[model samples]
Target: MKQTDFVEVKQMQVKCVLCDQIEDIDDDALQAKRLRNRKLNMYLCTPCNERIAKNTKKRHKSGNFHLFKEKKDTNDYL
Candidate 1:
């Protein structure tokens, strides 16, 4: 095909910040688009994500887990 078509169809290469694994994602996928536009959303491979979820569940079961939630200002109406 044409050079422009080839450029548009190219895959995006991204590295997982947590596991340092390089992965190729489709250029048109939603994840790819989010990563391209948002700086705070990092890529995590499936394995790493699953492992983290498992560990979080385990911690929750131990009755000592705490999640820090940001407090909203109470004086905003003043």
Candidate 2:
């Protein structure tokens, strides 16, 4: 397998807090969630994922949102 494919396989281990099921998430999705947590100490529950999305959207709309800096690109040299 290609190196990119290997990295993709490695990061698909995020589990749902409510159901205890591992989600088939790509690296981008996982990074987005982690970025949200870094900005706000928000944790995700399966039942509350939508709520979290709505709340963050509201916070953004109200100008009370926390924002994380973009991650450094891992493909710099290549």
- Residue-wise lDDT of candidate 1 within 27-74, one digit each (tens)? 888889899889538987778879988998898766442332212233
Query: Candidates' lDDT values, in order?
Result: 0.76, 0.56
lDDT of 2: 0.56
- Using TM-score, give the best candidate's number: 1
Model 2 vs. true fold: TM: 0.32
Q: Which stretches of candidate 2 lie over 4 Å from their true place?
A: 1-11, 30-47, 51-78
Question: Alpha-carbon error at 3 in model 2, in Å?
Answer: 9.2
Error of 2 at 37 (Å): 8.9
Candidate 2 at 34: error in angstroms? 1.7
